[model samples]
Target: MSTFSLDTATVLAAGDASEHRVLIISLFVAFVLATLGITIWAGRQTKDATDFYAGGRSFTGFQNGLAISGDYMSAASFLGIAGAIALFGYDGFLYSIGFLVAWLIALLLVAEPLRNSGRFTMGDVLAFRMRQRPVRTAAGVSTIVVSIFYLLAQMAGAGALVALLLGISSEAGKIAIVILVGIVMILYVAIGGMKGTTWVQMIKAVLLIAGTLLITALVMFKFNWNISSLLGAAAENSGKGAAFLEPGLKYGVDSMTKIDFISLGLALVLGTAGLPHILIRFYTVPTARVARKSVNWAIGIIGGFYLMTIALGFGAAALLKQETIIESNAAGNTAAPLLAQEIGGGAGSAGGAILLAIISAVAFATILAVVAGLTLASSSSFAHDLYVNVIRKGNASEKEEVRAARWSTVGIGGAAIFLGVFARDLNVAFLVALAFAVAASANLPTILYSLFWKRFTTQGALWSIYGGLASSVLLVLFSPVVSGAPSAMFPGVDFQWFPLSNPGLISIPLGFLLGWVGTLVSKEQPNIDKYAELEVRSLTGTHAH
Candidate 1:
């Protein structure tokens, strides 16, 4: 193992940055071209709505599982979580735990049932036992909202990650990167659809897991394979001493922070099952058994990856100065890449350039794959759920619906680019946690009620979805995330009053309560026959498409 020195790791000056820029740029270009070529190939085979929306249910269990990992493991996991751990220590590792453990919820509660019930979107499942138009509209609205929030995290991550690699620190430069990423993401969805997107995600997952493992192994090797030694070095390098190993660096500070941690935990744990992109991934497989198998595979892959994050996060702390990491990107999104640079051979060395380029290329792949998935999810919701069912009243041709989805991708991509410029300063992982909170609040309760509650009515679905959606969004709008703090999206203002950064604590329960109460107050009786059929379809897959 190469000896790691703080002096060597911290010397990536302008001269060295310029040296590494060409290699990094080349890798990024190669990755984009390769993925784009795959998309074009997949697009040629996409001959129908089924192909565009669900990849014609063509992927196997292991294949879909790989794609799921690709879709789920965002820059938030690779860049955001590593930065969090490198800076905040124990509190930051909590993100990985929350994200990995979330799959249990998806596996046990959602995967099989969702696959058995839904044809193309979450709207299909929720509208199964309710008034089709109203429920589909609500579900479509919720899907798009949740999806856009998730996309912002990807955009923010891409901007920060790419900005660091290119040595661009200006606001305008980062904004330009965001727009470029958005444009490329739109092309991925518009051209490749689900088939192309899935293939990209699958390839990205392998690269990410392999890249992370390399860093993790090197990190462990640096400390002579001693876990205690690695932690001690990290703590010493962080200048926080023993406190770094304990809680409260960022999250467990006091009563309010502890409560915020709980809210964040709730969002992370409950959010995965309700996430539109993840939920729709379940429909890409051929059977409910395959869906369950895919979740099983994802759990193994994601869980192992999270376990490695312990090393990647702490490794950065052990190797690089806190100030250096903070200076590169205040939110610490660049920690993993810097860590790779150090472990390979810091700064002006040839080894450093190659490793940094590889890790960064993998990270860029993560951002592109995730943004494409989120765009497809939102656009699919609009075209399949809102446009066809609501506006066209199911009279539109398949070709028209698919065409509308392609156009929707362009609009959504533009919106993400505009908002991403403003959110460029926040931590990508934290932003994703907020997206999770919204999904858990708005989508989870309604999904659960529709699946298991026989008494669930159309009013209850709307109240649960819309009420939860509006409340979580409104709370976030006034929360510290958007205003009232130096780290907020709008730092100059001070309008925040909400205590928790994540609204999951209050909004999740509120969604469930509204669903229950709305069911009780509704005059329309529950459709027992439809519920029975849905229940059977969900449980046994007797007649599931």
Candidate 2:
């Protein structure tokens, strides 16, 4: 007989490894079955490209709002941010707040006008006033780039979840998640189209909010419902508590980190309004007004969701105990789940175990819903903008376009999966920041200038998109991901070479400058008057005719 002496920590750590694999597999299988069922149901309604791309433009503001929330509150928002807050304290909360505040930009500036002007993609908004082929082509390329980056981040989160929950190798876990997400998302796009994706997002959004709320409540109950005591205890237990409440000098307090935080905040806030995948969701609504209302609704829900994360973070800190967190890789990401198990008195405890199970399951579902939305956005850009406009000169049949979109979804999903598998050990939070930088740089400048600037021309748009894309990508590659310097990716690199991990501060201005320069260099085309008038009416609801 083998005998093992178990310390309290070891016993706690080893508490119920028996049913974890079974629970994970069962939850995953349930997710697969539900997603497949939705796809099969949605397949029956998909009759043409428009139906597939925009759900026949029939969703209510509330339904679309929920879907938008689902798309926005991804795995990064759920697991990553919670983990960050648990680990870093106040800085993580800053990220959550920054992300939520960006929707204000959407509600006030982009939402109504975006839906009023575009049909399938942001290319439609750009092409509405410029050379159709060039603008659409540029927009398509930008969409693919941004979407792929976003997809990679989401897939990385999914793989990490599987590995953490199931105790599998990251590579193997990534493969399983990729195949599951890719196959499920492809089917949703190919068959159910926009309707299917929207419904999935809606359902998942509800599940996510409920799951998080339940965990938060339970966590508070375990901490005796005393907020001050909880905070004090957490702080006493971990030296990180003081820094966690007040943003660090690097992220929030220090001058240099403050500048970086502000820049990152700007990128996240503005970038949400300009993200191609997110913008496309407006077209799923029945009218521009509905799109406007949808943004308002999304703001409320998303805001509430972020608020709850504060309690969740505190719960992790107060109940999970500091020693357990340090032993579990020093990353706060595991704090919440670990807390759940401990409070439940091990995995054998029915209540805590079930709650943990549900939270993990919801995290997986969150990834699927968000990735499906992204895949649809990227695929539509390829099929409707690139294939139909550039390759076929807008003469392709609806069926042909729909087929192309379906195939493109599969391709993009597969590419994201491959990248996630290869980079399984990489930090996804950084990838998400990169996505925001690209969106802020490439897409936001073009969208904002086109909507508000009367002098904006095709030349300016082209310059802004390409210049922003190039600058952001180059800055990231050289910053840390590629160069193993000192900090996270490049910890030892000279500070002069890369002062900040995020490039939005420098690159966003460069994008604007390039756009202005391009406009000055090119004489205003004769078509500017007509296009500007159309855009004005679209914004103000005045018909020039």
How many residue pairs collide in each prediction? 0, 12
Query: What lDDT would candidate 1 get against the real structure?
Result: 0.84
List model 1 lDDT by residue over 13-60, tens digit each. 222567778888998899899999999999999888899999999899
Q: Which residue pairs of candidate 1 clash?
A: none
Estimated TM-score for each candidate: 0.93, 0.91
* Candidate 1 residue-pair clash tally: 0
Residue 348 displacement (Å), model 1:
1.7
Model 1 misplacement above 4 A: 1-15, 167-176, 421-431
Please, what is the whole-model Cα lDDT of each candidate in the order they appear?
0.84, 0.74
Model 2 regions lying over 4 Å from their true place: 1-17, 163-167, 170-177, 240-244, 249-254, 329-331, 346-348, 485-496, 524-526, 541-545
Q: What 10-residue stretch in candidate 1 is worst by lDDT?
A: 1-10
Candidate that would win on lDDT:
1
